[model samples]
Target: MRKHCCTPGQTTRTPSGTKRPSVTGSFPADPILPEMVSLAGGEFLMGSAEPHAYPLDGEGPVRTESVPPYAVAATTVTVAQFDLFVTATGYLTDAERFGDSLVFEAALPHDARAHPRVAETPWWAIVGGADWRHPAGPDAEVDAVRDLADHPVVHVSRTDAEAFCRWSGTALPSEAQWEFASRGGLSQQPYPWGYERDPGGEARMNIWRGEFPGAVSTPTGKTFTAPARSYPPNGFGLFNTTGNVWEWTTGVFDQRRRDHRAVIRGGSHLCHESYCRRYRTSARSGTTPDSSSGHIGFRVITAK
Candidate 1:
């Protein structure tokens, strides 16, 4: 794995002649045709300066952060691609080694009991065989999962994600890279499409529609894990960059605070405005990089 060595307290380092991977160096671009977007190097706004932006989370105090141009993957790694990595490398995801993975308890059938689940979130249950292949626990089968091959793979940890990137000759995007790509060159809009909830009354991203955790049967779209290319691509030709799943970034959760969690950007389908409105592009949440959950997976990045 290519390591980026930098001391603590420093936010970023100057671009160097150190070798970096090309956008499509490892894999052929036929299946993953990512567009190379130009993020004109300059100082742009970061964080929300509007109401309901949640001031306490350190999301704001909109600051000017300048980032050099770079290339990023168009979408999260798909099941077919991730499967290829596992087959070639004989890789074992953290969840697979741990014997259990975090699954949303509400994802269970209506007849399921709520008491036997883990305590913190009654909706989160630790199922013994909930690895990427078995996302819904032991009984859930992928054979019936529509488009299982092309859908973005979930139930992967940072370690698992980084390993896959290494095998692919790519790297995880830094948190800055993720935010910049997600913005799609638009001014700090609340949502990826814009600062509106389906502004024209059309769903731009696939997120929790009805009540959160439970009752998430999408009126039209929510069967489960939409195809990796199901939605409209962003300005950078990135798909599902805002909602389907949370993508892990290389940045720390808080380079400022004492928080021990690593940063995970772009929310998951399980997030609801009522509970977790992390679906916004600039919005961020974190968890232990070592922690693997069903909604947590990542996309890869290559050096520009």
Candidate 2:
């Protein structure tokens, strides 16, 4: 079975192979920044040894990793936030440049589903015009940004995220920094909140309910990304850290592999217990630096 976090869609090996218009003007001096949570930073147990964890993804061995003080955005960057960065920089995301990206099959219109799908995971369709602006391809409404303003921006590549970080005077959190913050002070727990997937029988994060890839519906009636702040924060006051979208981090997936696949933390709304048990803090996956998909997004951080 394919690991849930292993959705790279069609990745262009070399980022330089897909360049677009150069960014205009200079970085905005006052780009809007997302709400950031300051972590006092300390040693925390990292990785998992649970039977359900994907050992091949390097999600185990349970070691202690320490991070210095840093501040992470409480939520993943939203559509509105990404729009502001693009508007300020005249930047084009790799998806926009490629003229297509991966879209979840369930989110596509019936006709769009006919598009070529990733052979490894048929759930992802290679969708034209599926950039952050047109999450559902050209079918997305003109006000898509406003409609998804509060939702985590999807279909953004790590390079796109780095551009946003550069413009916003921030940086993508390292895997250690992200895990420390997502753990929310919890020590080696399966989730940010605690051991229970849903403590008190309540959903603490936005993830696939029922089943995955084909459920087509959820208990909340949302088959797509939720508002960035839809759920309650963890103990450290981070929102949607485990689900909603996979967040890009600064670290590489593996040192041994020559592939420049960067690490992506958390899972997304597509995750389910039946498969893709990656909504936990320690869980991780990786994709090409230039790959973009509807379920991939990122947050930024600042060193203290």
The global C-alpha lDDT for each of the candidates, from Candidate 1 onward, is 0.67, 0.81
Top model by TM-score, which number?
A: 2
Give me the runs in candidate 2 sitting further than 4 Å from their true place.
1-6, 12-32, 219-223
**In model 1, where is the ten-residue run with the lowest total lDDT?**
2-11
Residues 1-304, candidate 1, lDDT per residue (tens digit)? 2111100111121223333232222544555433344455455688876765656555788888877766677778877788777756677777776676776765554443332454445567666767788777766544313447677788787878888877677778887778878887778887766788587788877677886555655432433667677677776677888777789898776667675667888887776676677778777776766676667668776655
lDDT of 2 by residue, 83-146 (tens): 8878766788888777888877777766556788777788778877778888888874524486
Q: Pick the candidate with the highest lDDT.
A: 2
Sequence-dependent TM-score of model 2 = 0.92
Runs off by more than 4 Å, candidate 1: 1-41, 109-116, 143-147, 219-223, 255-259
Q: 258 in model 2: Cα distance from truth in Å?
A: 2.1
